[model samples]
Target: MAIIIAGWIDLDVEDVTDIIASAKAHIDGAYTENGCIHYIWTKDVFVPGRIHVYEEWSETADLQYHFDNHWYKDMGGHLRQFPRKGSQIRKFRVDLIEPVYDPSGTPRADFFTAK
Candidate 1:
């Protein structure tokens, strides 16, 4: 089973591009590390001031290393200087994570709506 680290950030309703860029950079660095399968960031289009981050790792220890790494520790400080309202973090094991198929036996055309 893989591990998933999910999180959300509420920016200060100001300029969010910078904070988001920083987060992407951090995730990019983490993705280059061992055991990292995926790292991505997204915004809630319906919610004006929302940011979501998802990380997938091959093992629990690798995910733990990410939390203990310098990027994780420094992100809070950097976001604080920006217009961040709050943040949340959660980690869980992925018992199953696979592609959803269409009725015709092809992969789902819409990634977001696949599940």
Candidate 2:
């Protein structure tokens, strides 16, 4: 099963733009980890001082390894440099994977390959 993490972080800085610029190293470093499908952090379109979090891992073991990596450990200190507010991040264990478009070339919301 795949693990998906999605949510937002409220930064205490004046603007999220500066923080994202400083996060380049951490973001880039995550891509080097094994079983890392995607890792990203960006500012929300309508929110100031808010950063949206999104990540995908192959499995629990992969994510566990990431936790022990230096990149992961350093990110905490980087973020704590500023006075942060509340954060809401959630993790989901996905049981099925499928394309958003079906064979007929039509987009659908329901799962077509779940059986």
lDDT of every model, 2 decimals: 0.76, 0.89
lDDT string, candidate 1, 3-87, tens digits: 8889988887844665677676676778777789988777777777788888889998887788888767666566677666778
Q: How many residue pairs clash in each candidate?
A: 1, 0
Tens digits of per-residue lDDT for model 2 on 17-95? 8888897899889889998999989898788788999999999999999999998988888899888888999999999
Q: How much does candidate 1 score in TM-score? A: 0.75
Off by over 4 Å in 2: none
Q: Which candidate has the top score in lDDT? A: 2
